[model samples]
Target: MSNFSSDGFDLDAISTQDNSDVIYEVGGGATVIQNEEPAMKEVEPSFNTSEHDQCEEFKKQGNEQFKIGNYLEAFDLYTEAIEACPSKFTGEEILRLKDEFDEKQRSEALQRSRLSEERRRKKEDEKKNGVSSSQPPESSKPQPFKTFELSQEDKNDKLAVYYCNRAATLQHMEKYNDALKDCDVSALLNPKYTKAFVRRSAAHERLEDTEAALKDAKAALELDPRNATIRKTVARLEKIEAERLEKLKEETMGKLKDLGNSLLGNFGLSLDNFQAVQDPKTGSYNIAFNQNK
Candidate 1:
């Protein structure tokens, strides 16, 4: 009724006056107050965006996208983020995104890998398993263990297999000494390897020697653990300790036999005990060869 619209009271002026009399008008008249600070948030940090920070940004963008419910895009973004983070950042906070993303990725990757591996393995396994196709055979995969018999090639192959398999088993058994020997033999047979080293590392773990174990593990991991046999070996070692002391002893004995054979071969397989008898005329001992046949 006081013509409120006509005056349109000076709100700004009122606010200014209120500001001045804030303390006075209240019980603490004319008192000074500390300034109110702005609330901090999970905002992007101000540090220079290095490759690591850039990766963080990618992860952040992914998270932001996820919040907006763009799941696919978020996933892709996170993938890029992880890839961008670089190997150096793997064990770092920068790589720290939602564990769900990683777990999802790991599950997906493992699933896909398993699927593909299964298919390929089946195809290969079918050859051995006799799960022939409906049609006649197009070709055949060479057997993994086509080794010869009682020959150098055979020994080499058997030794390799023995070492590789035994190394795997021993790793599970936590038999470091024996497992390491098998690994050494595996490598000797075929230097290009990851399985043996990886298994050997597991054996080292059983012995509670992390340093050497880590070294071997890293080396083996650096190689291919995707192999079915290698993966199986790893999996076996994961839950149990598999040792082959008997296998090792057999291998050692075989090697010793081979060594002895080689040495005897060099000497024409003869161990003749001979003493030099003096030749009276020349005052020199004649070489007497006592060949005990």
Candidate 2:
């Protein structure tokens, strides 16, 4: 005899309830939540870390690498620092500031126009009434214009330093043109930066632009007279320039001589047939025909 109790207990009903409960739990449970997917936790977006702080950190790393003569690494770090820099305000903020500036400028312009009109009217009235005086009318004290100072978003000093350092790295890598561009940017940012000028001079020297090199070296020397390197650089560039000019002069004279010889050959009278003799008194060369070749 099987031990089975009828007792109105349906096993099928219990199995069905079990399956339904499992499905409901997996499906997020409860009749109100039926057919609904599991709720996902709302995640708030994280704000970016301070750009100035990041830039400073990268700059520090770059300087360390530069000191170790790891130029490529230093350049990369410097680039990252530059990219991380928040040099300008957001577009919306800039627009708002510009609007305010424009409004203020418009108000000032209107005021100036009204004042000019009033002055013109007074002048005309005086002229009509024959109120001319020998002495010039008392000049009104000039009003002090309002000075508005806008806050800069980036650290200009740091940026200039980065550019100057990067230029140095590029120069060491023999990338003269790239180095020169960086040096230019550095100098524009900080006009008093002597190192930028010095680096720029080096770049020009490598590019064989002796004149530009000398100019920058002189500027650098003026800024830092005690710098022996700049003095030596200036001397070297001047010598190079002199030598280059002499070489160019020789080349030009050689070309002219070649042309003359070619033309003389066409006439069946080569340059060898002519002898130039310097007149002792006049210091001028006189051409003498040579009968014997």
Candidate 3:
């Protein structure tokens, strides 16, 4: 401190000139920061809980409109709900979260496995000791395994419901293709959602794609086996698919016969000269060439 000059210690002696840099001391060293531009701030992604509440309100309004047969109004409300839903994480943050989630899942699985093994060993020991237990005690009973999920998955599930409801409205308006597109998004968002497949089946049926409709109906039935409506739909689709295939078979056979007759006419023969007999057991056709005819 004694070696320091008074001019160096004087605050007024420092130049507050017209330069674009500010000099500051850190660890007895001077550092210059440019004053021409402000430092950029780092922005963090945040979920707005209020927006999720707003989305739920919009969905309820849409349901009200749907029940009253106002399909267009319902579609608008559902679309608004979909738009109000918060965006999910993406990029590196999502990747990091996914890794953490996977690790947790693996740990839970290992824990469950060890617990199951321990229970089995305990039961075996009790049996050897002549324990008179007809069934596992309440505490030993297998508890339900809860499915874990990420926050984004929860938002996506809500968004899926909105898309599915909108798709139903589109179906009511006879916009089958548009409904199909919406159902596609709904199913992609939540594969376990059965209604999306049901709505898609209806749309495909309206578009006269019996095969596709049957497939989706069957899928819906599998997802909700106890649903009477889904079961009925699957049955109806199966019958329609069978009839369609039969009609297609007849048309194909007719076309083949015509082609055969056209080619055989060059030799003064016809398809009538070649009789097709079907084997009742095997459902195979035999073509016998009758030259005498």
| Candidate 1 lDDT score at position 258 | 77
Off by over 4 Å in 3: 1-48, 88-155, 276-287
lDDT of 3: 0.67
Clashing pairs in 3: none
lDDT of 3 by residue, 187-277 (tens): 6566666767876877787799989988888887787777676677778778989999999999999999899989999999997888988
* Candidate 2 lDDT tens digits, 1-293: 12111121111121233212110100111111012232774322222568666876787687667656677898899888766755453323433564677679778867877886787688888899998745466445554455333343222445566676677667667787888877766665556567678668767876879899889988888987876656777787788889999999999989998999899888787678999999999999999998677
Worst 10 residues of 1 by lDDT: 1-10
Worst 10 residues of 2 by lDDT: 22-31
**In model 3, what lDDT does residue 91 have?**
22
Question: lDDT scores for all predictions?
Answer: 0.45, 0.62, 0.67
Stretch of 10 with least lDDT, candidate 3: 3-12
Tens-digit lDDT string for candidate 1 (51-102): 6567656655754554454545655665565455323222222123324345
Q: What is the lDDT, from 0 to 100, of the residue 123 in candidate 2?
A: 83
**Per-prediction TM-score to the true structure, in the order listed:** 0.24, 0.54, 0.59
Of 1 and 3, the candidate ahead on TM-score is 3
Estimate the Cα RMSD of every predicted model relative to the unseen true structure. Answer: 29.4, 28.8, 27.0
Comparing 2 and 3 by TM-score, which wins?
A: 3
